[model samples]
Target chain A: MTSSSLIKSFERVKEDNRAALLTYTVGGDPDKKTSLNIFKSIAESGADIIECGLGHGANIGDGGAIQDSTYRALSGGIKTDDIFEIIEDFKKDYETDVIIMTYQNKIMAYGEEDFIKKCISSKVSGIICVDWPWPLNLDFAKKCKENSIVFIQLLCPTTNEDRLKNILNDAHEVVYYISMLSTTGQKLKVSSDEIKKRFNLIKKISPDKKCIIGFGITADTINDFKDTDACVVGSALCREITRSINEELNPATNVGNMVSDLKQKLSS
Target chain B: MKLEKGIPLIDQHDENGYWGGKFGGNQIAESLNYPIEELTREFEKLRNDETFIAERDYYFKNFVGAPTPFIKLENLTKHLGGAQIYCKLVSKATGGAHKAYNAVVHSLICKRLGKTYIGGDTGAGYAGKMLSMAAAKFNLKCKIFMGTKDVERQSINVFSMRSYGAEVVPVNSGSQTLVDAVSECMRWWTSENEEAHMCVGSTVGPTIFVKICAWSTAQISREMRKQVMDEFGEVPKDMKLINCVGGGSSAAGFWNEWIDYDNIELIGVEAGGPEGSSKHAAPLTNESPIGVLHGATQYVIQDDQGEIEETESISAGLDYPGVSPLHCFLKETGRARYTSASDEEALEAFQLVSKNEGFVSPSLEPSHAFAEAIKIAPKLSKDTIIVVDSCGDSAKDSKIIAERLGYKI
Candidate 1:
């Protein structure tokens, strides 16, 4: 997809007054079918975007809950290819945008161009290679554009202007600005005003692109996007889904309930 | 003619030949196999590379003050009544220890990798000291993860590291010691910003680290060669090189350059702690079988289930239950001999050295090396030249020894 198309999607989501529900689930958790069910449930529950997590042997960004989910997924024979199959199934059934978030090794192992082509064929809208910075991954961004897949760039609080400028220049679909210094599933301790201020700075720098604040975001803080284009809630939703699966509850029903509650909270 | 760049030196043997048959080529976990293998290959090229050799030679000769004057202890030799006793005074090295050589190379590699921050695990107190020096010299942000218990014990070194602008992170994990500090440092490297690189403090893992550490250690042997020529008018025919094995860096360093020599006997003195053959010995010498930790497969003092076993040594430096992979390979190949020294013996030797040489070498490493020398000295003639690495100065440890032994310093 072109940069203009991504801008259009961002504008449409912003105009609908709907906080984009970005869901994250480890591919093939418990089993492929169960994980696929979780993905379908999220898409059906009004998730505007899905992040299919490609679990690495060493997950630097994950906390305990997501770690356990990934362990369960791996033990159930979930591999990288299994994630693509699930994404393909989700695409056949739903019209939501899917993004693959993984480490650079995974992409390099699968061959970056081949991985991007697989994502395009599976109807994935974007890709987030976590460990690859913009300056280091300019060639990767070019490949993504050639394959009609948006290359998402991650920005953290520690990122200075020089690095941010590099990221904004290469960013295609959305800018995922991390709200806090810590990892996902952590509490959102930073103030909404502070987050808004950072988002405003990012927005001013990349005026045409959608800038979203992620990492440690929850349903309670969905309204923190008053001055931002989008707020992506991932780990919180993944945590709740994991809690349901661990408690032996119906994951789809529990996920539906959780997303509905989040929708209501976001709207209010 | 201009020398191009890096060159490969060490012959590429089958994994079993170089790794003691414990670390087979295919044994590395699938995830880390490529990077580690690539690193090993790169290291082979760098090891013999003319520039690397020249840089190593220059650092040893100038920076470390190599040919660290060999001191013959007439009193100790006469007291023992056997072989000629000599000490390779590594205490004269910059940073007051032999670790400076390896730390410089590690820091240089991190800088080459574009890492602005360098983190290391400290137990021998050498990594922190040497890396602190490297950080200041190289203008890199340095973080040291030291065991809380070790921090309390080695306050002077900790203070020195801080003085160098290194952030000393005290780790209170399992056993609150070096192993725990290493694990915590690895975790920190994974979680922290990607711009930082974790410098393995020893020659235990990647062949590149081993090669660099070995090059640093070769200073001792190189100096010994010169000393032998100066004293005996030739290289001594019956010479033995001795150093203590703590995570096996010094031992590997010394042996790496001399392993190909047919006549020299390379002996690694390991900590026996309180238990000799039972629990407390370092991994390569005692409990560990063939298993991977960090990056290389070596003898690890691990449990039946392959979990890393906790170690206890009076000396914090020797408490790690693992040794360098090349040392493991040497142990298997019969090129280098391995021995153990009890805490009691090491302490006794420490006292002996202090009284005889008027120099107290701190940490059990030098004492352990001395203990081995003492044991082996009786079997050899007075003309035999033996080199034991006096790894560090004992000024700091003297206080602890006095307090523990009820003696005045």
Candidate 2:
């Protein structure tokens, strides 16, 4: 099998001795043209991976900030086909590993096998479905593997040893560890030390697979999880976009500056 | 009253939660898997424990008014001039709805799990009232998530929940109905899983929850089966069980006992919203494509892009865009048939049942079922028997019912 760009991106960041800064933004937040510009800004601002979210109506895993952004995207007329176009447009201008993050219904509605094929053609790197986990995702992940697309598996603090083993056994290139048992955009409920202690346990269980911390990692908390292969800063960036739009500022520039600052925090 | 042994239909699912090798599973966030598995284990243990069974039976008999009367609607059957219409009077249950069955069982489970806090989602607010009542009885704190829209419409139930010292959190998210209420409740459960138990109001969530709720409510069918045997000396030759499908708890409860009896027919009624409108909450009848919603893979009313559609219905309890995965399995296998009743038709049924049967205040949720039964009852022969689960009282629907009836109450 060919090496996935997602794995290569992690390897490149591993050599730098710093976790990759994965910036998340909805595919068509605010609007379509500005969404593409935001993606360009995110990539140019030193984000190793761009987790472009597909706009969904009900984002159970997301908190208010991400949910607002998703609603904005949906109201702005963003669709699955439009999201792919945005990714194709971004891949033309940048080599950032672009993983599509969405709920399960989007992929299921788009046809799972055909969705993987679309990812391959759009130069998308991976997929993170917040609602699909473990045995339910087993088949979809297998199909993704055949097309060299990384299917990211999600784990949480509540995940026990048996389930953890089963999930990692089927995991592909990367695994996402939700820092706490909450929706996105919430402040990290557990201390950084506690998160590290749990993350270390996962790392000990799987030494080779790349792991990332998500759900609670913001600029303030991103550096604390630097031991992981990557950190996904999602709701914070979406919040920045929301704030920028509310304050009549340039969202792309503001989001780009936020990502750059987050990257700087990681290296420091 | 001992718990019935091994419900074959409810237990037919695989270990992973699929029913009939097609629908139902824990299609949830990875964080929820461990807790759901933990719940599955505890529920399994409690199901067989004699003491637990006795405790649950005590609550079912004494508190929830279990063995709710299965009586023939004589006036309606004679008026229809066709099928013998029978009604399982579930509205007679305490808290005025069948939700009390699931709520009492879930609250007992919460106490056994050593959790002091219990939460649930409510649509027309029956679940909230039932859970609050049960939680207060068990000396546990209760919180109910309700859509803001429903909060406005279901004031009576809201006040009852509050009177029980339960907090009603108004959810201001998508559509502000039962679907969003469930979404918000699940999100809250994700954060509070350590200290709280989520009592899902219907059989529409992940596999374990669906199983738990179905198990709790299936007692209705068990009692009805015994009643049928006592009344007719055997199962009726041509019988149809009808119940409304809003996440499909009462229907699951009313039909699970009869799944093995192929001669008995199962019919589900869905909310069809306004007359001649494109929007409705009839996923099973609308031929909605299969997708995952609220942790279960089922038929969902969604657009081309897979976003859940905005559903409408006269009954807040039935204003949902998704149906239970078990119902999906039933629909796929052709073991059960589903149809829908529009708001106008249900309203007409509401009036007819009140006038003919003298049940002055029937809840609109089950009125949808009665609407279908009314439509088909007049067509079948007198030998045919149709049983409709009268699942809720109209206490919470006074405003909607009065306004639709041109009254200012």
Candidate 3:
């Protein structure tokens, strides 16, 4: 029930009156060591919050972009426990708030209570999973709150405003407003007016709740969602890392450049 | 249905909340953000609708031939010696096997859910044929994702699906078979179109889909159980029920009712591939450890690194890395027994039944189960009765099995 680290991270970003920049990196993408290095570089490059991906090879939650991203991580022999080593490594260099956006299977296999304990111990500020079946999982959401870990809510565009109001009431740390109904890497189909309308509604309902737009928020398109509190850069950055790994280049530095370069533009 | 240790949905998850119990967990009910209650409501409403049931009954009786003849395989029973073995002639159903039941039900549910585009993955081509036909019957656009290799091998099956005015998409991913096709189907659902509901052709998925699919197929068990009671005095003393399992949809339906039966026993057969080699789809046969993949927790066939290992079997439908989560629970709790028959044994059973019974082509999936039945039937008492499900027609598998066995059919 106390203030989560994710809130502090957002507060730190707001010190300059700017939205926090969040990046998602699936652990063991390509390899574990390089993934850790990429995390450190992205954290240093100016990400206020970093979201790590978790799934046991089969990703039924996110779009195929993340699915393909997980394929690389899993193909690299990444397991759930390996994520701990990578997180521990990243925590050494930066206080960037860490959140694990994972599939429910990973948490279920690791044991939900045990997973929350690990999240707290790993200094993970927030947790969101696709498999949590929403209201059916509200009890676990309470458990997460008791453990002082923020249970981030995802607001889809397809959801009506009434539902958004209800979801906003329980939301904490951040509201991940998916910009469109499409998956990650799809063309931005929502107009700025609609994005602004939805974001404004979330803000109007709970100005206290931080709202960040995700899904198809690329480097160029990120400008459209500038009015929101933050934009989650996942598939785009992961794609850069994938390109680096595929071409035998330094993935950590290349992805570092991708985020750092985007950071400068978002700094506006 | 109550059993000694397991229920279909509850026991499948072993205190860990995997509806498949330690074996299956990690299921997305419908879409990424779909509320569980809505999906549950749809299933409940559709399953109970009087008109839907009437329509379902009408379709099964007239089109797919439901209540398929539960007949004693007199020739095979006499040859096996000890017990009188019967076959639940599902192979005689439309789409040439037990696949018609689940496929038609899936089609109905998809149409009820107002899904415009119905998409899913299939390995054996039987399901694809059934689903596409259902889609065509219901006037819904259908697209099926099959493994590139399976589509090529089961060319006639692909043709059958397409002939129903459904599009056949070949997935050329890892292994280029069923598992890869499932992955592609999921990707297609999440990435391509969120509105298009996945018509998963298995009894192993999220709680709602698993429960509903099994519930739909339970009609088979209900019909057969009634026939068994009518034909025999009561349930037979040594009644053994055997069915082939890729993802265990038919077995789920078959065992759903018999779970509470006192004298009836359930046996699930896995594809053991060619003998003396580790290349098999036998998750339970090898006592596979608990793992999660493709959205459910089940006994997954995996290597040391935890990556899903490829499954190799004579039947493409049986060529899956995992079985239903319920089967895993049944095996782990000892409520049901699991055994695997090798490709050679299955082929022998296929030829044996085809030659004596003159039942057209039978798919390799049920052939594996019939092989196991053929194995134990002789060891039991003469008064004992055993039932093996002729799960699918072999018409789709004819060319492949013929080519593999060096027969020019």
lDDT of 1 by residue, A1-268 (tens): 5334445666777898665667677777768887888888877777667788886533345655666677677657676778899989987878777778776546655766778878877777887766555554678888888877788877766577776787787777577887765556777767888887888888888887777677777777886663466666767666776888779998767776777676666656
DockQ of 3: 0.28
The per-prediction tally of clashing pairs is: 4, 0, 15
- From the highest TM-score down, the ranking of the candidates is 2, 3, 1
Alpha-carbon lDDT, every model = 0.70, 0.89, 0.76
Deviation of model 2 at B286, angstroms: 2.0
- The positional error of residue A101 in candidate 1, measured at the CA in angstroms, is 18
lDDT of 2 by residue, A24-56 (tens): 889999888999999999999999999999967
lDDT of 3 by residue, B1-409 (tens): 2234345443344433354334554455223444334556787787678999988888878878878778888898888799888888778888787667777777777777777778878898877888899889888889999999999989998999999999999976568898888776766666545467676778666556566667767777878889888898587777889999888888888777788665778899999998887878999889775666676767878764456787788888888988887777677667788889999999999998888677634588899988998899999888888898887888888887889789898
lDDT of 1 by residue, B227-326 (tens): 6677779666777889898877776655555565668888888888874446675665664565545444567775533345567777777878778766
What's the true lDDT of residue B216 in model 1?
A: 58
Error of 1 at B73 (Å): 2.1
- Which wins on lDDT, candidate 1 or candidate 3? 3
Off by over 4 Å in 1: A1-268, B1-62, B191-194, B275-278, B360-362
Q: Report how far off residue A211 is in candidate 2 (Å).
A: 1.1
Docking level for model 3: acceptable
Which residue pairs clash within candidate 2? Answer: none
Residue B164 error, candidate 3, Å? 2.3
lDDT winner:
2
CAPRI-style docking class of model 1 based on DockQ: incorrect
Chain A only TM-scores, each candidate in turn: 0.93, 0.97, 0.94
